[model samples]
Target chain A: MTNTILVLESVVLVLLTVLVAGLLRSHAEILRRLHALGAGLDPDAPTSELASMPVELRSRVSGSFATAADLDGAGLRDDALHVAVVGTRHRTLLAFLSSGCLTCQTFWTAFGEPARLDLPDDIRVVVVTKDASEESVSALRKLAPPNVSVVMSSTAWSDYSVPGSPYFALVDGGAGRVTGEGTGAHWDQVKNLLRQAADDASDDSREVRIDRELREHGIAPGDPSLYRTAEQIAQESRA
Target chain B: MTTTLAAHGLAIGLPTGWEGRIQRRAVSVAAEQTHAVVHLANFALPEERDDFGGGVTPLMRSADVFVVLFEYGPDAVGKPLFATQGIPRVTADMFGSKRLQRPLPGQLGCQRFFTAHGRPFCLYVVAGSRAYLPRILAEVNGVLTDLDVAP
Candidate 1:
């Protein structure tokens, strides 16, 4: 009888473990949904491990900015783009780059000719590099395009949690949040990523509008009208 | 929205549709002293420009405005023009054609000398048209309001 009881208790303990695992998964899903809805993210999340690698790109948070202050060896150039700026109304693409990285060469050239990259006319592109202490101002000035601004702020690298050299973050100015961020091997990949993120953001807004309209018409989510009945589906499929 | 750009012991917040740069020429000769030159403009700046803005000032449209903060040698620190002793606050009324270093038709310019952070500098402003002074100066003032100099 004692052995039987022990086996029963062991079975119950295994069941309990499975139950806890399920609950944990559900909680994770809930957190993921919350993040999708723009909730509970710390914009000031500390710099990540990726910035140290200087070869991959990852996403990060808010940062500081300073310009017109470090033109000592910059020659005739106006200012270096080693600034950390936040965009409010316009979509700003923060290219967290390093002066010493060879991977950044393509991006620098692409940004100099942003029009050829097929970016939207409204996007404001800026490059961010480490502060003067870690970079060569003259070299950066040489690589910097006459039209684009290269902000030099080490805090920007940390603010965005950039681990290494060439990473890109697309900050939605209207939403005031990073929509998508990752590293790309070249400008084409980076441009496509940005375009895709912009498209996704717009689609989300479209869905939200549709949802609002349905509610305004007294049709809540999961309403019968939102989904066709089996008979209607059959008829549509047949047609 | 404004972008605050701080470099070379100088800082300024550039307003929307405006850009600014601070540059210091290295002392190429022993007799020549180094000083910072800041250029702020509402329109697009060209690739080439002198310390006094000779190349770009001519491109200003009727509603455009150009500002230059040209730092002078330390010897001019105590001069009467530099006696104001701080970043000068610009008023629309302070600009006139007579103050232009090289005046051109339809453009009115003003110049102010001041010392900040023990450095003497000239604040020169040019408005494309006097009729647009109020609007032009308002934008210029908004940009300069964020001006700073660190020792």
Candidate 2:
């Protein structure tokens, strides 16, 4: 009888140890999952990691810029003797420059080389300089790229509310809006501005297209159904 | 030497030497969520120009100041501050208070945090020269203290 009682006690101890170990393992798994969810929601998470997550998990971020002063009042050149900014069907890069600005001179010197600028083909480059006599701007005109349009406008500076020389504005002709505007002290900054504007334009076009398609199908782009399928469609299309 | 500037239910005094402009837009973050963003640009040295590098630098290339007001939904109350592109993260001491700063090239940068209203806002200021940082900070501190946000 003594031997049997000792054996039963040993069996109970073994069973209890196994159960505790199992509970600990399950708790560890739960903790790991919680950590992952926290990391996914972290704002500082890397772009690559955010991209891999589902769209619903990623939040939307937006930005805005001050309204650019109207260019209509700006008396742009339209004479046969000089190139005019007659609006283009595609996006236009309106580079505000002045002969009096040393910074503007640097930009013009670099802009004279089309190969160096290497702007996307879809974007049309137009240089808007202060209205000056042909003789006054003759030296600056010679530095302009052959393919780019150079226009002289008296009100261009104030119309755009340009803070300083070598300011740039990305004008979306189709939308009739200034997509992006800022001052660039170097040629590389100008290139970056163009690239960013191009990306923004592309995104805008995609959204517009999606909205139009949804409207055609008798569904509002704001409808919940559209969003439900947007991510899946975006994933498939991207793939 | 100051002018009254107002936007997003808030009003403040702007220095006379600065050119203040505001932009407002409605942004759709999710299908069921949409909010407004107010962007303000203050040009301190409109005539001066500086060579600020590209890629992560904020706008107002040469000594300029910018203020961005972001409105978040009720759900964002407890969330971390959303990281904005092009603004590098930094630690700085401002007016005897320690705050996280986002310093861009050319000494142009901003610092942002959630306000009492649960809205994320940023104040960006650029000095014409490094020597002007102290003066700029004082001015920025005044603006922050004087800001009147609508509840």
Candidate 3:
């Protein structure tokens, strides 16, 4: 009877050891996954929403911007061009990137120029970096598209809500709301969505017959930012 | 009782010993802080042997990339320590050898880890001071030992 009891006890101890070992191993895997963005980073989630946004919002999001504090720094620079900035009455695409981010550089290479081409002429591409120096500025100039206007600011880190090295947001400027935000570099999806939104705004305007009227008056809808209202902008050119 | 790291087919095992979920993908990597990893994989094939020389030479054959910051010891100064176990020796001849021709004033070292010779290389960095060198190597070796590459 004693022998039988001893054998049973040994079996329980072995099983417990195995169970505990498995638990710890599983725990370690969980920790690793947490470190790696909870499985893997998804870079293609937001590309389809580009065409559904409001024009004012889209224009502002994609237009050149000046954080209040950065304007002061730009004023201190040698070449202080009075760059055009869109007002905050609509949605815009705000991108935050770091000089040290390799992924940003990679994504930038794939999407930078092509992205600019897809945007309406008025939807300017703007970038805000954490530090602005002559050398860094020069490097950025080489990397970004011709249509891009880059800004260097110490306060960019704080103003951008850039929780990570590279992040992006589609903001509804009129509503003062974030339409969408992502933490990684997903250029294809972002470009597609932005293109779609631009197309939708254009399509919405086409239905109103405004393009012919603008032609008759000999006024081109030169700047998407200058128009006060979406209806007015969409209607002004209609016949 | 003692926690020792182990590897099981691309996934590292905890000291407690559990089965891993071999995702068979290169993980994203970052240095010290605020870097995010995405699951997109892009790999370019090296046509010539000289193409992947120096720091640019990938540690693996597969093109998937996983990033990690590599750290090493103070003793590794002036010497090129091969971080990957697959290639025991990475002589200057393999690369053009022009870049490291004149070693810097202080200890100049490189740090990285690998699962295979031509796959995604993990992140590693040897920056600033030699103070953290020993701790960095130990931590890296520990992580590497835990990784198991399947045949």
Candidate 4:
């Protein structure tokens, strides 16, 4: 071949090689992002599931009424009830709670019944609090998911199991095992796990009527007799 | 007696002569780059600290000092843009611990609190960052040095 032609061919080859490498690197980055999205759904799952499984609070309750009754019967008042509520979830919703927790206050504005309308019908959400009082629960209830259960467990502060506020767990109620648990920077990921748990339980046949169970345990369902009503709760506590 | 310290960053006014040394510092790895530290010397008498949970030295006690660090700036209102660091230590050891005490992550950031003199103060301290550390400390030290106390 002519010298000029040889030089031109070499130049073309180098350009093609660069283009190929660039494309591969870009492809890898895209795959990495896609994998991250996929991992949000399930560590081993594909990307398509992430969109289909946006973290949501399913409206339906988890845990057996029998179990809730058992907890109530055990005199799990105030904080203990909160623990039971957290324990009942298919996934643990770390209660970013404290009488003065700033994160919980931020989330109080972000999460709530009206805001969580976008969530599915079966996801169970709960609030964990260090200070479990009728007043605190009333204030928090205004900012929680509808039909989302709440528990104020001071024991959670010392559970030694939970490292900080806003910690979460994937609880298998049927198995009573914490299938997945984490703290700090994984709320969205844990929310995804909660949705996943609900999806997983879509096929499991177990139902617990919380109110009836509480009644059986001699704990009234609509509202505890300690306070006349939600409005009076704050005042009563102050008194 | 109510003594009001002028607004520097997140603090509106600190109670003067309340037996506390307020030092401000900028945090380097926090959402809010600037922060402050308020070390309340002679925080509480031994009895008061015991009345409340002991994990934190209650500001109401005599021996306890409330050391708090937060962000300060004009753009501080109604924004998730600051961090807070608090340490309940002894008045003698306010500056002993180099590591900032951490509260629950999301639970912290911004706050409004009252001092013993009933002066209102605001705070926003971000974690792991030190953007305005020097300025915060200088201003707080100046205030403490100039404080007029009632014996």
TM of each candidate vs. truth? 0.59, 0.36, 0.29, 0.27
Candidate 3 residue-wise lDDT at B112: 38
Give the per-residue lDDT of model 2 (tens digit) for B1-151.
2445555455555543333333233334546653334333333211111222122134344434444445556676555664442222222343111221445445545455464554444444344334455666665556656556665
For candidate 4, the share of real interface contacts preserved is 0.00
Instruction: Name the runs in model 1 displaced over 4 angstroms.
Output: A1-84, A87-89, A112-115, A136-142, A230-239, B1-21, B27-30, B39-67, B74-86, B95-111, B115-118, B125-151
- Which digits, one per residue and each the tens of the lDDT, describe model 1 over residues A1-239? 99999999999999999999999999988855544322325545443333222323232222221121111122224453222233233566778777677657768778787668788865667777787778887788788887666667676677666767787777765455667677865676777677667677688789899999999999998888778888998898899
Cα-lDDT of candidate 2:
0.51
Once superposed on the true structure, which residue ranges of model 2 sit more than 4 Å away at CA? Answer: A1-87, A133-148, A214-239, B1-151
Residues B1-151, model 1: lDDT tens digits: 3467666788787765566667777667898868777877766555567777788878778888888888888789788878997777777678777878777888888888888889888998888998898888777777767787887
Top candidate, metric TM-score = 1
lDDT of 4 by residue, A112-156 (tens): 532442444323444555544423555554655543334454554
Candidate 2 lDDT, A69-108, residue by residue in tens:
3232111211211121222245667888776655566677
Off by over 4 Å in 3: A1-78, A81-91, A110-112, A115-117, A120-122, A133-135, A172-178, A192-239, B1-151
For candidate 1 chain A, the 10 contiguous residues with the lowest summed lDDT are: A64-73
How much DockQ does model 4 earn?
Answer: 0.03
Per-candidate DockQ values are: 0.12, 0.01, 0.01, 0.03
Summing lDDT over every window of 10 consecutive residues in candidate 3 chain A, give the lowest-scoring window: A68-77
Backbone clash count, each prediction separately: 27, 0, 42, 41
**How high is the lDDT of residue A155 in model 4?**
50
What order do candidates take by DockQ, descending?
A: 1, 4, 2, 3
